[model samples]
Target: MVNKKPSSQPYNLLPEAAQTLLALMHAQGEVARLSEREQLFSSLLDSVNAVLWAFDWESRQVLYVSPAYERIFGRPAGLLLADFNEWRDSIYPDDLDYAERSLAEVLVKGAVEDREYRIIAADGKIRWLSDKCFINQQTDNNQRVIIVGMAEDITEKKQLEGELQRLATTDALTQSSNRRHFFDCAHHAFATARLDQAPLTFLLLDIDDFKQINDTYGHQEGDYVLQRIADTGKAVLRRGDLFGRIGGEEFAAVFPGCTPQIAQQIAERLQREIQRLSFSHEHQTFGVTVSQGLTGITDADESLDSLFARADAAMYQAKRQGKNQIVSG
Candidate 1:
């Protein structure tokens, strides 16, 4: 049996001119292939909305960044190319630790990481970004560990979520906390007050002759009156006070670390503030007042309902005693 191997010819075996032409053609073909590959990579990255970036972990230097970085981060690519600190400095101080911890996780554990954080852009505006990144271990003689990552601008999505949360927890009529949110805050305040044995005051107010006002002035005017009452009450309340419209024409306020006497004084001032609001109907101008009931947290055993009921009774007492006054329970 005869064994035959593949034939081979060296370029030197050819004429000099022919060899040069062959080498030139081969080089041209290689160039064309590289050009095609570069075009494909550019097209793929250009179509993606996210920022693509790579860096050497050891040197802490950025090797490459896609064009989207300029568009999304609002900074020139040359800035990131020159120094990675420029990108690091753009992170919001509050979120800097969070971003660093994510990077540490990837570096130490050799894992992919996804994190959301805020950055101050070149435009002096805050932006939210969702970053997904991974570290590629050393795979070459240079022992270079590369970090590749992508980040997408999520500022608009975060804003939308915040709006939804506000709508869920806020009263539409007066822009005050809604019933559920009020109780949520009140419960937390109650727990804290109990733990510290601090005096927590609660105030409940009802619009005087609210139903009659609605019947006489129409719902729109009634709404305006309620709005005015809420605005006035909020203005008179202190900074730490929590005010909420727990019911129609009825509102509740909680003052942590306040005495019943001081709460009553604040309520009286709120009543006066309400009386100052001028409302005109047809040709008549009139002002309305609120009847307030105030109470302080007596003990840990008292539930929110019981304490609120006491305040409600005092408010009705105010209604019976002259219609517009502040009464302490």
Candidate 2:
């Protein structure tokens, strides 16, 4: 068997121009593939109502932006890439530092869950956006790369949440804080007063003969009386004082940094005001009155239950003595 020698010409050799053209072809193919992927992604994003973006970590330059950018940001995607800092500059001044810090923390930590911020659009409209991003750690180098974020408009949802919170904490009838919310606030006030050694007083009031009023004048008139009492109480109270409708015809007020004497004065004033109010329904005029009980936190017992019990006892005492009077315990 004869062993043949290999040819002198380089076995893998091709013409220089052909190789160059081949390299160019491969590059073009890659670019076409990427363009197709981007188009598909853009179409997907456009189908829904969300903004998508990608930024190169090293250059801090925007690499890809979905069409929704124009809808949300009111600017062409090209403009965002043209000036890398444009997007950052559009953040609200109050949120700029916080947004930057949050982004930096996520970049350092290699992932981000969700964050909310306000952005100024090209049309000068301020919009709230919730952004979510994740870092791509399986890169060829140690260079940190973060997947650009997706932002969704959450203004309506946030507004609804605020409204719900208000409804939960406020009394529907009198528009004052409800019993549940008042309890929470009073607990905090008690804690603060205990810590500061400041005097704290509470006033528990009930409309005298409320059941009789409801039966005589009808329930609507009774409701009107309650509303009137709430308004008058609010008007006379200081700014830091807390008042709430605890139950039907029953109201409570928490006075932090107030002594029992001051609370009694305020209670007396409220009693006088209620007696002065005259309600006319269907050409019939009637007078309304409230019995008030006042109690201060004492060294014997510091619990809310104890304080409330004392106040309640005092209120019942007032009711027993007379329909309209202030009793202190």
Candidate 3:
């Protein structure tokens, strides 16, 4: 866990950011005090996992770099000090335009700046950096302005955020897309199909006699059956097809650029694959089959709800005709 600094209020004291900037602000005379303050800032920054530096805004020349450069950027401090290209080259190419624009905003407004971007370190490993900056001081000549900032390594934080997002979007048991994420993907796929005038197939699959399975084998085994069904259906679906467990004992798929004939063939293959799965529960070997409702994008299909309603109607038709069968609309 991260530690928080003490929040005690002082008499007529400035905020944390203002205090930091005040310490960094340059003044005429008091050379000894300035040197001591510089040493204090350098020491404090060195103790933390951040690279503190300053540069000329106009000339883009490196003015100062802290020792932490070696640990974070995987290079010696002298390298960054030697040439501006070293710093420029480390920035990810795709993020360059945005970084420049953000910095330009900072220069114009003199407001504090913060941005997150990727960097390629000297070791050739990609890293995430949270860079922060503000104008520390401007020269009396106005030819050059001092920009001060620190870069913090945020790769681990970014990875954790990504994992959290995956967990939120994924079904825990079946390891497929959850209901919310399924619709999010389907909406995008729906727009693309409409624009390109492409054939898009939708499948609503339901397990036959799912409640009976739970009654006989228990909920744990019923979950296993559902997993097997999802696995089987995914194997039969084409690449780029969207598959998700929308409900208990029910799954859905969106197949873009696939015809109804091909969708029916894949549904048949999925049924066969489920039939091939056998589970030994309470010393009894048994299998389960699925019923599917298939539908394609039509000229009359104005919304996802309409398309899903058509497929859902066909799925119920399959259930009415027989437990294990395919109904197309």
TM-score of each: 0.87, 0.75, 0.75
Let me know the TM-score candidate 2 reaches against the reference structure: 0.75
Alpha-carbon RMSD, candidate 1 = 4.9
Alpha-carbon error at 92 in model 3, in Å?
5.0
Q: Candidate 3 versus the native: TM-score? A: 0.75
Which ten contiguous residues of candidate 3 have the minimum total lDDT? 20-29
lDDT-wise, the better of 1 and 3 is 1
Candidate 2 global Cα RMSD:
7.1
lDDT of 3 by residue, 210-270 (tens): 9999999999999998888877767888889999999988899999998899888888888
Q: Write the per-residue lDDT of candidate 2 for residues 1-329, one digit (tens) a residue.
A: 99988756552477788778888999999999999999997678788667777777777888887788788888878888887687888899999998888777766777676789999998887888887776665456665575677888777888888899999999999999999999999999988988898999988999999999999999999999999999989977888999999999999999999999888888888888888899998999999988888999987766777888989999999999976888888
- The residue-by-residue lDDT of candidate 1 on 1-329, one tens digit each, is 99998657677987899899999999999999999999999999888888888988888999999988887778999989999997899999999999988976888777655689999988989999999888887768998989888888899999999999999999999999999999999988978888898888889999888888888888999999988888887888999899999999999999999988888778878887788889999997878878888888986456677778889999999999998888888
Number of the predicted model whose TM-score against the real structure is largest: 1
Span of 10 residues, lowest total lDDT, candidate 1: 299-308
